[model samples]
Target: MEFVMPVFAGIVVIFGLVKRVPVFDIFLKGAKEGMLLLYNIAPTIMGLVFAVDLLRSSGAINVICNFVEPAADFLGFPKEIVPMVLLRPVSGSGSTALLTSLYQDCGPDSFAGQVASVLAGSSETTFYAVAMYFGSIKVKKIRHTLVAALIADFTAAVMSIITVRFFT
Candidate 1:
């Protein structure tokens, strides 16, 4: 594994030399472009982090989970997994923290833990991804992309619960 990168780099250098390509200069250019991309996307990432922190700190997630618990139960979703479902589309880290908490509270062998694990694997950080990608490209109007992504997230949550219940 350690030698793989060096070997790949050697192959690339040899290929560049044979092709008379300025590999170093090209690498520098790519690095500069990556930096510029990071610069452009940094604000979006920061805002997302701040928003997620604020929600967690303010107990907004708890409130939402409480309000949604009835519907979740009606739909056969575990009460303990509500927070993970709510956060999964918004922040990957937040959802992961919720999943870890669920694991601790309910045990990995518990139904809620199994559901959280499946949900985490099944969903995407929809808002974060859309914000970063569209923000980097300077696309202000997201059209129906946000709606579609959120719908997919909801579907993943529902299916995660259903699949886990079926298996268990």
Candidate 2:
């Protein structure tokens, strides 16, 4: 395993050299482009981080959780997962932290833990992804992206509950 990366790199360099490609120069060029790309998306990333922080610190999460509690119950999702469900699309780390806490508090075999695990695996940080990719490319009109992504997230959450219930 330790040698895998080096071997892969060596193979790539050798292949590039054999193909008469300037590997080092091309690597430098790609690196420069990557750095500039990161610079372009840095603000989007920071904004997401800031938003997640605000969501937690503003007590808005608590309010939102309480507001969504009845729906969560009716949907057969654990009330403990309210935060995870809300935050999953906004921030992966935030949702993952909630999932981890759920696992610790509820035990991995508990319904809350099972639901959290399934939710974590089944969905993505939609807003962050959209902001990064669309912002980086400077896409102005996101016609169906947001709607489609939200629908997918909804499906994942519903399926997470049903699938976990069935399996357990």
- CA RMSD for every model? 2.9, 2.3
- Candidate 1 residue-wise lDDT at 85: 83
Clashing pairs in 2: none
State the local distance difference test value for candidate 1. Answer: 0.90
Model 2: weakest 10-residue lDDT segment is 71-80
Per-residue C-alpha lDDT of model 2 across residues 1-168, encoded as one tens digit per residue: 999999999999999999998899999999999999999999989988998899899999999999999988887778888888899999888888888888889998898888888889889999999999999988979999999999999999999888988899
TM-score winner among the candidates?
A: 2
Candidate 2 RMSD to the correct structure: 2.3
Task: Tell me how far candidate 1 lies from the true structure as C-alpha RMSD in angstroms.
Answer: 2.9
